[model samples]
Target: MVITKTLDTFDSTKKLAGHSFTSGWLLNSLRENDKLYSQLFGNRLVKDITAFDVSGGKGFLSIVLRCTVFFVDSVNDTDDVYTTILKIPGFDSFKNDFLTDQLRTIFTEFHKSECDFYNILAPILDGPTPTVFKTVEWILDESEGCIHMEDLTMRGRTMTYFETVNLAQIKCLIQHLAHMHKNILCSDTKIWKEKHLKSSTGFIEVLDMMNESVEVLLKKCDFEGKSLK
Candidate 1:
């Protein structure tokens, strides 16, 4: 994965902030999720692992990390390197105390929803999503939740902030959206029944949050009259 561009350079050898555990902890976590790990890497012995926090300023709800695992198969006398992305809760690093306190429940729900999506829906739908390695649902007391998946950057390109997207790109995105929607509808409806109801109830709250955010932006901007309105 391309880690040098937007992500800051981090020391992979040392334990970093935002994470309570080291590379060893990660390996153990993977082992604990034996079924998934076996499906992906089989019986390869993981010798060493290096991790870098790539979240930088881009992530608001979660911290993103890129990890490289070096595996050795003694029987086969072969070694291989595997790279993946690890995402964990970002609430610890979030500086807005007022907002954090007010929206903690909402954030927790969102995180759990995402974890479930990756674990359940992602595999069933033919969407352009990363390949999942592991997903830990948010725990109440422990506050431990994470999503480990493939780093698409290895094969994909990121668009710049002000880059103009052409018609062809827009069409491609629309096509992907359509495919995802079709898969969702075609899949077992029971999986999404509760989510559809939940989302409907939360829609007004989301709109209120958006309106408040816009008001704050309007107060900050120097635009006058019609432009400001």
Candidate 2:
């Protein structure tokens, strides 16, 4: 009777046969205690959560301790919400040709910019540049011939998204690209010159792809007379 009452803290006694939650730890035990979380989601990495309660990051950071197919939390005492950053599965399911083409294009432009930074235009910058990335929880799912990325929970962490997307990040991305093409961005200029030249094929391709995606998304979401409801 005593043990049963303590276990009732979760207020529900549904036991998932082979699953459990990570619990008993001080910081997490108070709110997230449950054998279900411990057993069902033991693979996730945990991170420092002291500063997240206010950053809209509490949800994502909390799940770091337990990896699962999706993020789940109780939205209200009566509701459970599950969210994920990438929802379209693998590349095969990501069939929006235009969006695929756009991502590839961005990758290509990233390559071109990298070449310039590595060979000619890069040497002028005297110091190392900063790099940042935020994961996007959703991307447009196109395999069905429409635009849709899984919209995320307000608290779930995601890749950086922009209010007004711009070209500057592409330039920064190129710098990262330069790092990949070590011949160009590394500390060896002599070797960079020895290697072949840069190409704009990637840059133009990405720009064109993103432009197309933006146009398509805007059109699809227009509320003129559509039943998007």
Candidate 3:
């Protein structure tokens, strides 16, 4: 089950599942170095943060949260609550498993790749994407990485596990991918190829584990008799 609670409920000294989710961490994750964000949150700091787990049956790569922020001073009605999507690397389900180390490495690398893309390529790419307010790669510690992005709950929708994409949507996605690939190709191809290649031998080493996961999922779906195309 998912839980939603304020940061005050968690003890500052205690480590939460080998990770820290303190208010200080939240503040740091939400902190943006942009001029506009600075001006918007000028002189006002996060009074409290309430995180709601929204990652059920979504993806196993990371933890997804809908975080609501309350400022110290509620000068206006709009200052009451601010919301953003908070994503942290690591899966709670695999915390105690033997796969924890391998999964952590994979997830952390994926998270860092995303952070790098947004930090380096998104500006030049010609595709519409969510605004990333803040993104950090895993540094010395696993808890040091996070992503605070625009809340697109109202503006967009997500597909279910068994849902199939329609032709139009697929075409649109292909068009966007084509545009992005064109932009990338026009730039330094060698740099991008060397840095972002994912088909290396090390990457494929985890394919067996991934296939095992998919088999388990397929068994569950078969039990439910859900037709997947």
Candidate 4:
């Protein structure tokens, strides 16, 4: 994977911003004028590219960028703007540590799982998930990759980590999950079998440890509820 440092300084940011696509080599291989590109950009010539970091707490595993592409169609005398969420795997600096090593494996699997979902599964399901424009596997490692997906925020999708959700919103969320599960189960069972389990040994161990700590806290408080098993 091509590791790019964080854009901390103005000069560094400006230098990267000047490039049409920061990963020019990968983009070139994708072929800007291909059928897929035409479908994505509507055969419009790219006028400008702007990117900004929008990483959340998962910045250690991946870098999320909000990329805006401005395009112009000379033949039709029209212009349009496309916004996409670009996800790139993080660097390998933390791969040597015990905890991080496990995370690295999980992260790699996540990229492949998403690629499979977008390329194979989503089309058949006709799901409401955001559209994936392209997926570029790393030259050095196929498992580690990057992806360009439709920006759901533009379609009124919002995310809140700790905010309370209303009953209606909760019902809608549950319905969406049910629909996805139903579609997957009704589709090919073999394809979805044991392919995308999100838990690892390290993750389960940590969860167990947290549960032990919580049990101790409850004992100290003399809680009368049923014992946490």
Best by lDDT: 3
Candidate 3 displacement at residue 102 in angstroms? 4.6
Model 3 C-alpha lDDT per residue in residues 1-229, reported as the tens digit of each score: 9996543333334332344555556555556443444567645755566677777747566777786666766675364666677777765555354364655576567777888788778877957888887886775343467777877787987877799999999999999999998898898766566776542344576677777677678897774456665
The TM-score ranking, best first, is 3, 1, 4, 2
* Index of the highest-TM-score prediction: 3
lDDT of each: 0.66, 0.35, 0.66, 0.58
Clashing pairs in 3: none
Candidate 1 Cα misplacement greater than 4 A, ranges: 1-18, 28-47, 71-80, 196-229
Better of 2 and 4 by TM-score: 4
Worst 10 residues of 4 by lDDT: 8-17
TM-score of each: 0.68, 0.24, 0.70, 0.60
Q: What's model 3's overall lDDT?
A: 0.66
Which candidate, 2 or 3, would have the higher lDDT against the true structure? 3
Q: In order, what is each prediction's RMSD in angstroms? A: 8.9, 14.4, 7.9, 9.7
Please list all clashing residue pairs in model 1, or write none if there are none: none
Estimate candidate 2's RMSD in Å.
14.4
Window of ten residues with lowest summed lDDT in model 2 = 142-151
Please give, for residues 85-148, the per-residue lDDT of candidate 1 as tens digits: 7888756554453353436666667777777787778776777787776777776457577787
Q: The CA-based lDDT of model 1 is what?
A: 0.66
